[model samples]
Target: GVPLSTNEDSTRNQNLAALYVLPQTSYPTFYDVRLFIDPGYTEAFHGNVSIRIIPNINIDQITIHAMAMRIDSIRVVSDVNPNEDLFSDFTLATDDTHLLTIRLTRNITALQPHVIHIDYVAQYADDMFGVYVSTYEENGRTVNLVTSQLQPTFARRAFPCYDEPALKAVFRTTIYAPAAYATVRSNTPERRDSLKPNEPGYVKHEFEDTLVMSTYLIAYLVSNFNYI
Candidate 1:
């Protein structure tokens, strides 16, 4: 979480346990996420997420959760400034800080909204959490399937976001996948045209915006599996 106060702030208690919890300086209101995954050709997937957040107080740093991924870029957009922020991750570091910290040159005003944009890439998880690939036999050949089980705290492994248990936001998600051989499913049914000239042989599945909900409740699946 972002450091909202300096050590001299006597009103704030710097307890030892505070290190384990995220500071609620800024919280997410919405998430717009797009993903491209072709399980037939690669194990890694690419994604871009834009998050809308509101600051509870003027803050110079923003921290959110992420794990086991490469964030190619991150930027904060607002009337104040549109430049990118310097960011670092401690997902695998000794502090057990799966937090992504973005240092800002200017402070974000309290109650003002801004968008945090990030581009990232990560391999499909083998563990049951987050977005992952599973296999099944279809006509004597192994077939790859993509699915998610983002309950509790695993959504960070899928996309960078405010991942605390109580943090909730509206989510709008999209997926680009093989058109002819794949079926996509999400919380809502809002599939669109299947072909794009720029993305040949791929289909677009844009889900409707979710209700105000926790990140863990966001779910999706990509495969040729039958819809039941």
Candidate 2:
């Protein structure tokens, strides 16, 4: 096995309870995140994340963190050729509960910008952390809401990310849900919302890009629950 760096040794277990700490070899400078909730009570929430990053060193593998998600796809695109995609030539493995190691065909240029895209189905936890379902009584009916609590290391449960408290990045987030469930909130304020024509009964709420912040500080919610 390759020797783990001090950063890795310290962060490998940084999850809410784990003790391994993953090293910081690459940094995501920006992230574009989109989520689609079932509207009804469901644990299967779809997510799409696009991240712009700069690697600290030239390397053939990219290791990040993820947990409790079913990844459908992973791809990389270089800024030099935005039209070209490098999805077919890579292998991704999430062998551990909080580790996702991606092996690429070629070495990524050191300090150069690259974009990573991931499509996945993430679970809504009952644990009340990292994109979970919340329940409450409303108007004489039991209401279920979809929300996110990414504090500490729970961000990986919602989406693939560095999952560290020190790795901060800008985020452009969007949430898709039934129009009837109108309200959505995130770390930042809403930019605009539009009907999802192809997916009837759904509206996509887009939020403005966020100030640089750690993944743990990220929060989002989709609910019909009234605000006091």
Candidate 3:
């Protein structure tokens, strides 16, 4: 049996929450995210997310919320000046804290907008949670569905984000799934694929840019549900 500690040092966190949170240093303004998930093959999901942020102070470290994912590459580019990359290196604090610390070779000045682009592959939620699988009975057969629940602090389980409730921002989201799952849903309606890719056994579901909202407000589902 495991011993339980009654000490305040074991319980008290700096953020006054169960887990640590983003420091709001990089004030995120908008997010452009794309996910490639095959419902038939649900072992893992591949995706990328780019966040436009305005730091209020000059800092070399940019920390964001991330959980249950592996980061492949990261790049920081100035919004006003895109001539060179601003990213130096990155490290993931994958404890219960779920913070990704990005170190920059040079400091990003105050009030300047920069975009952080991250490419990674992430695993599906273990349980009925952030992008997990559920089942439905249809004609004496079980059908698997892929969906998401990004309430409260669960958005970080789906992607790397500033998942705080007060950090509201616009979201431009896109997804890739099998064509069999005709029903795809997001907070906003699906839009036409202006930049459609020629991926095999997959179709694109692009959604209209959502109005300014917190990360937890976003929802996505992919299933061949028999509905209008």
Candidate 4:
């Protein structure tokens, strides 16, 4: 339930009862997401997401949605001047669930595109939601499958995003996992896959960029299930 708006603009006038349904102040046009899953572990699936956004007005801060995820680092830089406008201030808004605010030292020009890069780790929950773990019995042994079911507003549970249907963006997603241990799938077809150098028993699978779609439509899964 992330909305985009400049800090100076105060136009969230929707009866004040449905503040959660307000439209975003910033719009995302494209995204590049990378994920690493260790199914062997019980928690902490790492991920990195890069988003290209266009704001309606000049803004010094950008806000998105996230829940039950630990943000490791956030880097925001203008495409025009990567070194000049780097921001370090990251905090949560008051009394808001899944709301993440990033304050930049300088205001970003309106209608221009800026890249927001985020590194975070999310837990694989037992419930089916954003990147959860599903279990089954294989050959009399218990097995776990790490998967996702981001529908409606659950995308924030996996990675930071607008987490609304109004915001549409193209996505390029990649996954890294132990080779031959699991199969990776996403919204788009796999573009390529290869063994990761210097890391044995690991492989990287890159997916083609998705058509412009809402965050709810974007998905990925890591599992050992075979195509029968």
Q: Rate the local accuracy (lDDT) of all candidates.
A: 0.79, 0.79, 0.85, 0.79
73-103 per-residue lDDT for model 1 (tens digits): 8778774555645233223323556778777
Q: Candidate 1 or 3, higher TM-score?
A: 3
For residue 73, model 3's alpha carbon misses the true position, in angstroms, by 0.8
Worst 10 residues of 3 by lDDT: 10-19
Candidate achieving higher TM-score, 1 or 2: 2
Show the colliding residue pairs in model 4: 4-24, 4-25, 4-26, 5-25
Total backbone clashes of candidate 1, pairs 3 or more residues apart or in separate chains: 0
User: How many residue pairs of model 3 clash at the backbone?
Assistant: 0
Candidate 3, 1-228: lDDT as tens digits: 897775675557533574575775678999998988777777888899999999989989899988888999999999778877888988888578888899998988999999999998888887766888777889999887889988878888778999889999999998888888988888898886565465777888989999999999898888998794
Which candidate comes out best when scored by TM-score? 3
- Quote the lDDT for 55 in model 1: 90
Total clashing pairs for each candidate? 0, 12, 0, 4
Q: How far in Å is the alpha carbon of 211 misplaced in model 2?
A: 0.7
Q: Taking the tens digit of each residue's C-alpha lDDT, what string does model 2 give over 1-228?
A: 997578766665455344345656788999888888854858578888998989899877777888888888888878988776655443334455477777776787889898989999887877877788877887798888888878878999888898888889998888888876777888887885542223556777888889998999888888875671
For candidate 1, the per-residue lDDT at 143 reads: 90
Query: How well does candidate 4 match the true structure in TM-score terms?
Result: 0.86
Better model by lDDT, 3 or 4? 3
- lDDT per residue for candidate 4 within 42-137, as digits (tens), equals 677888889898988888888888778788988898888877656769985455556788888888888988999999998775577778877789
Candidate 3 Cα outliers beyond 4 Å, as residue runs: 1-19, 193-198
